[model samples]
Target: MRSKARTQILFFLAASAGVTMFGMYHVLEALGYIAPPRPFGDSIGTVAFGVDIALGVLALALLPSAIHHDPMEVEYGYVGPPSALVACLVILSVWMVSVLAAPAGAIVLISLSARLSLYWTVPAVCASLMSALVYQLTHSPADPNISWSTVLGSVVLTLVLIAMGSVRGLVLRRQAERAKQAKQARQAQSPQQTQSAG
Candidate 1:
């Protein structure tokens, strides 16, 4: 798709997700399920929603550059697709390791891709671990109920997010590769065409 069209679609999706999350935050507050952000009259959480929207918009704006200057496409070919799929597996693995490991190694290594998948998976892993710790500590020390179902569901969510991110990166990478290859072909054929014309 053309850059403008892709930008519009991305912006729309981002706006939709922002609106939904923002609404959920409010609904949680209204139901007294989630405590609001602190301070006399501050709405930090709501502001965070706006920030998310803004970041999405910014990303949509920068999408062209990301496509045009993609390193994975230029240097490694269509690495994005496999990289994206690997990302999902990594997210699930990281979460599991984070929960079970005394000192997690996945988190440290995954940090290298903070710009790709770690940005969200990192926080999800932290939240899951923190939640598990709370649940483990609150119950009888010997008979803690860190429900397997809850952990499984969280792991699944992170895995899905990772997949989505990977696919997105792959799409951009493919575009960059196509552009680069086409540029090279034009350069290669130019000399042959000139020789033939002479």
Candidate 2:
């Protein structure tokens, strides 16, 4: 059970990191630092900034899970119902995969998920669809040569995910070993206890 919890935490952390990187890429785009880039309109740039902060906060929220045994044991309680949780996971998963396909829309998905209101789920879904549509409309023919900064950002993001995964794997392994040892000790003591009782 503990190991299962640890695995969840690790996956959460990796997802958060991936989303944050996606968000940062948007931030950079808004700041006029990258390619296939557009002039930063005030409204969209502000939205992008808000999206970046929201993602960073989401990432920070997972910090407690790193130290605590069970994330659900936290005081605030779980995010929402199992269905909502599943939706968020699905949304996040799709965005993570988008890093390879449509990197532009990754931030949109994270921003939508951060809203977290059950009522907003449908709107968020629609917004994501619209955002992707706009992105595709803007850049239909994909460029083979992406900006160097964008390339560097992707590499860094990949490294962060890789490192987090390694740590999470180690935690799960240790948890399994401990559980196995405890089980073996219990088995070893059972025969002795039985003999003494006899």
Candidate 3:
């Protein structure tokens, strides 16, 4: 249990650091603190962003399992649910992180809420609102008016991702329940067989 806890803490710390660094890199590049790659160009950056989002999704999706001390002890019907205070802290943390890494942070929030059996809509709505707010705040006065279509697209994308994450969480929970049942059945039969043999 100590080892498992240590592993979980280390994994979370590493993931958080990786996401933060990636986010800061993009922010720096945008601010001209870091130069964009000349040869590979923005394509490489796009690919990297996609990969980061993918990894964030995978990590958040598997977070519930990671939190468990033992899968067999999962009695919450799905994944282990966080306390209200923890949930609030998570939401606030994601919101703050999204300011720098919107896509990855938004997806992480959505997946985390879904996996924890919370109202996924809360994070989805929060993500969409945050995206729009960021866009408005960041929009240059010299640039053309804010594009409503882009904002709408972002909202739609957030919703779709939330839906997908929710579905994935549901599937994972069902699988875990099935595995738990099977293990219990085997354990149940073992004692009966031993008694009969004795």
Off by over 4 Å in 2: 1-37, 40-145
The segments of candidate 1 whose C-alpha lies over 4 angstroms from its true place after superposition are: 1-16, 28-73, 77-148
TM-score computed on alpha carbons, candidate 2: 0.37
Model 1, span 1-198: residue lDDT tens: 225675455445534554465467568876889754343234555564454345334433433333222244335423234443333333333323222221122222232233254444465466545544453443233455566676677556545544655666567558767988999999999999999999
lDDT score, candidate 1, position 106? 28
Q: Where does candidate 3 stray beyond 4 Å?
A: 1-73, 77-100, 116-120, 141-145
lDDT of 2: 0.45
Q: Candidate order by lDDT, highest to lowest?
A: 3, 1, 2
Q: Write the per-residue lDDT of candidate 3 for residues 1-198, one digit (tens) a residue.
A: 115776466446646765687678779977999754433456655755564465455544444343333343246653433442243334323432233334334445444545645554574466456646554444332444666777677667666766786786667668778988999999999999999999
Model 2, residue 83: displacement in angstroms? 9.7
**Candidate number with the higher TM-score (1 or 3):** 3
Show pairs that collide, candidate 2.
none
Q: In angstroms, how far off is 122's CA in candidate 2?
A: 29
Q: How many residue-pair clashes does candidate 3 contain? A: 0
Local distance difference test values of all predictions, in order: 0.45, 0.45, 0.53
* Predicted structure 1, TM vs. truth: 0.41
